[model samples]
Target: MLATTRNTLIQLAEIQHQLQTIHEFFNKWQTNPWGFKEEYLSEKVLVRFLKYETESFANREWEAHRKEIDLHIILQGSERIYLEDATKLTEGIYHEKEDYYLLEGPSNHFITLSSAIDQENSLFLWPTEAHKTGVNVTDEAVMVKKMVFKIKY
Candidate 1:
């Protein structure tokens, strides 16, 4: 789960270089939808495609991916993402393969993420960060545009 400002993402040339690979993959399924898949680009990074239906709320326990940074980009719809500091993560078991740990306790604080009004870019998430993404309680289908790229620290 990656979340951050657009400017921050553009500054990372390594990430910018990989955008083409992501775009190529996104172009294949823009008309359709699917779930997460690992697209290996090289030893330094891997692109992950994720699709989730928009709903009132989505609470998830993520497997920890230590030392890797996540780049999240929205490709279709709009939704809010909540992120909390991993140090405050007091719950959830570690699933090494998935690369994120679930949080059982109440989150202390969170950063909110929504669609970019100006451009399409990726949001970066540090390793061990705990986060949640979805729409608020409402009766509508929210199309979420996103891409998660794993980067080695």
Candidate 2:
């Protein structure tokens, strides 16, 4: 997993394609319909935009993809995302259509994201990284608009 900001994107010039795709998505997807849907960025990368109310960690399930890397970003509101090593968690059934495995265990760590500020915290979670997202940052549930870019691994 890696967390970074928009300013650091240029420094990763070696990964030109991926970086550019992310930048384009960041600019183009800020507005439009705020809901659960997929937008193709390229042949190998797609953006899944979601907007919903945050929930408690207990209600969130750990999930990991088998063939894609998830790049998560918050476009509106705030939420916490829990992440941990998928291999360390109890194995669960893999959903082929979704390309993810359900896991059960304690999250090792978490990161909070807020769109009101210019923090622009972007996280990349590889297939080996299991994560439970859309978690509330505080005791009360708040709505959050998030985008997950699915890139080929």
Best by lDDT: 2
Number of clashes recorded per candidate: 15, 0
**Highest TM-score model number:** 2
What overall lDDT, based on C-alpha atoms, would model 2 receive against the true structure?
Answer: 0.81
Q: Please give the RMSD to the true structure for each candidate, in Å.
A: 5.6, 4.4
Per-residue lDDT of candidate 2, residues 18-137 (tens digit): 758878767754655444488787877888878899999999888999988788888788888898999889979998877889999996599888887677567778677898888988
Which tens-of-lDDT digit does each residue in 23-118 have in candidate 1?
666576566765667668767668776677666544444334576777777776766555667677575666666566666445444443456576
Worst 10 residues of 2 by lDDT: 7-16
Residue 105, candidate 1: alpha-carbon lDDT = 47
Models 1 onward score TM values of: 0.63, 0.82
